[model samples]
Target: MIFGKKRFPGAVADFEKAVRAQDGDAAQEAFARLHRAAAKAGDGELREAGPRLATLLPSVPHGPRAAVAVVIGACVERGADVSACAPGILAGARETFALAADFCARWADTGGGELPDPDDELTEEIIERAGYEPAVGWFTLPQWEMASVAVLNDPAVRRESAGTAELLALVERVAEASDHEFRCLAYALRVLDDEPLVVLHRDTGTGYALRMSGIGDNFQLHTLLAGVLIGGKHLPGQAPSPQEIAVCRDAPGQVETVGSFNLVGPDGTWIFNEGTPTDIPVIDGARLLVLDPPPYRRAWPAGRFFPGMRGDLVLDRVLDAAETAAWFAKVQPAKR
Candidate 1:
């Protein structure tokens, strides 16, 4: 519309200018405008701008990179072909914008639900050779169990037993590597036989939890948290189910039940309570609360929703506030 170019093109120009100026705030605002412009642009305009927008991703500042990636994801969601952006996205898979990059990659791969049939001739041949019948649609329970056990028992997989000391060391390493931007709180739960539970509270106000079950070594720990940080899932585990709480006001009685949690990564697997709620010892824990940042900031969308309970379900009313706070005060920081 301006200078013979459409709104999208104009917005792209503004974004490019902001990037050139190395202005983080301006870049963020420009990216937002670009997203709006893309939404209003026609399908033809989107297709034409897709590749150009992708090329700008690498030049975006770290603080605003995720925002830019979201714009690209929006374009892809609108049916724009931005497959060319995959390489840059994969390059930054470990960076802060990982979740958005993952969303873009997934959208490109599935075209938002058009995936290739998994039960093709090659798959059937492999199934026959493995002495397993080809499943018509989904994996049967027995098949799934067998596969899971096989993966668990694989020789290449790495597993380690970690105690309190090793856990502290791992947390310190992750914090140092992320320059303390990756803030989280760890707790040692007595109910789970003293397993360490890590709750990552991001600057975006999004939170995620991982229970360290003395599984894999530090590398696995990094990978697990990294996937969680970006709101993506590179592992498999049981999804979280709601727990039932009972209250009897007249009788002045209350019953608390055990909840389930699981995480399976390349190196290790963790299963807690097996997705069932049962009567057990009261759930009490000492806090290893490390960094507590204000819970208000940018909103980052998860590329793949990890199977876990909401923060309130995982923590609220379960832990004694006074006791936990006292324990947190007594805890010392892990030595570097």
Candidate 2:
């Protein structure tokens, strides 16, 4: 157990004390100190509490969850023998209430639950592959789940009113696309709530708008644009291969062709402003694509405000990069 009854109770006690003090600033400071100590604990008493800490994580609220996640991440970062605890840590961080509820209930019954057998060998591989970092790991789990849940709740895209199957598929596809699955999930989450979409570039002379989706998810824009550029005459579900994506990206402006650009619904209903017609095949479910520019342009000048959380400056940083575009394209659905 990482933080059993007999070990490292002082750290947990100090954290709980600060939390009960009702002073947000002091609690934040306490969390910071806890993280520092956990990171430096190495193979000391705090390190010994790893397994217990994993099961203990889910029973707490958001603030302590953040602190505990940091401690677990620090253990993983330092290559500690936390193999027995990783699954619980991940489940706690992710709020798998079905799995964690029993752990929490049991903790309430007896100060700690039975330590699960260590699977550190496999869990360590998963953590390393996901690039777990103490700084971001804690925040990423809940945030990523939030983003995925929002997409499922979106009426236009929901496969069913419940949307559970669609949500799981979304998570799986996103993980497959990203080198760091958790990091990608957090990025996806932020864009859903905070950065929906914005016109990153506009033509002053023509009054045309070129918008990009905020964060890369199934509805990401870059892949659709690349598919249009390379697979011009194909219809109904042809996506660009990586090599083809590269070709389209290398010269995006040059690939602009005769067909209209669109953001379409699952039913083929247009979401974005309509564009010009052409020989390009209409992909019935294409969510975000560009063949031609949008008819309306932003009234404001370039670099002007968009009346949202993110500024044009932030959009510029994300949209203008080839690597970002590549990553975004990977997360988007191949067909729609």
Candidate 3:
């Protein structure tokens, strides 16, 4: 009967009532409606509603807790201050739904307090013990999703089929010219393609491609790619020489060098000591060539990279030339 009625406050009240009564069905319906209402609400309204909904978390039924957490996550995405909700969110995390807990933890404000190192490990163990399914659809999370769709749509990110063919031919020629089968790890940042990719080559003819969309920055991307090459058994017949291991082990912690490498284009333009592979411009047919020792020693912490988690790296598949070209062609890059 009321004209221009505000939906957020009313929705919040209904949600709180459902939680208080521990009515799972009603809570679910209420949360869905609340989520829709939240989408329409202004930032100021969301900021006000966030703390109110957080207070109801302790009373929320276990069955509906994850749904509530999702709502809270949306609130945080819209500039809501829900720092007061950390204790309740962490509590629910300890109780159940570890996957959802991990998602919610990103939004929780810790007041500049670091989690005790041992307790942090114990919590990770508990989450592992929960046996949650692997997280997928990483692009759904705001943080994981590319900040600028315009960047992803840029034409420079797309490589022409002719360029890809040339790159394959170049790899073949290099392999034929070399003594050992060509093998190395390479990374490509095609922002228009949505995810940055790391290709691990056991041999020149074939390679495994992993989507590293979850990597936070270029530095993390370099570090993780290096870690995977070193720690993993990607090099089949070739074992790292003792000198190679010693060099990696003795390298200074903050050294910027990612070993000796050449950055080349399919057209034969080459540069040396320019920077890490990641620093290369996003041009069609550009490549980073690491022709030195095979990576077979651990140079970074193992636990830093989370496989199959949201906003973390996930293995895509093994790809040869044609398959790789097909994958690249699937997404149409934005034209200039």
Score each candidate by Cα lDDT: 0.35, 0.36, 0.40
Candidate with better TM-score, 1 vs 3: 3
RMSD of each: 22.9, 18.3, 20.9
Name the top lDDT candidate. 3
lDDT-wise, the better of 1 and 2 is 2
Candidate order by TM-score, decreasing, is 3, 1, 2
List, in order, the clash count of every candidate structure. Answer: 0, 7, 3
Error of 3 at 239 (Å): 33
lDDT of 1 by residue, 198-312 (tens): 3322122223333433222222222233333322332232212112211110112223322112222112222122211111111234222222221233122121111111111
The better candidate by TM-score, 2 or 3, is 3
Worst 10 residues of 2 by lDDT: 300-309
- The candidate scoring highest on TM-score is 3
Off by over 4 Å in 3: 1-5, 23-26, 97-336
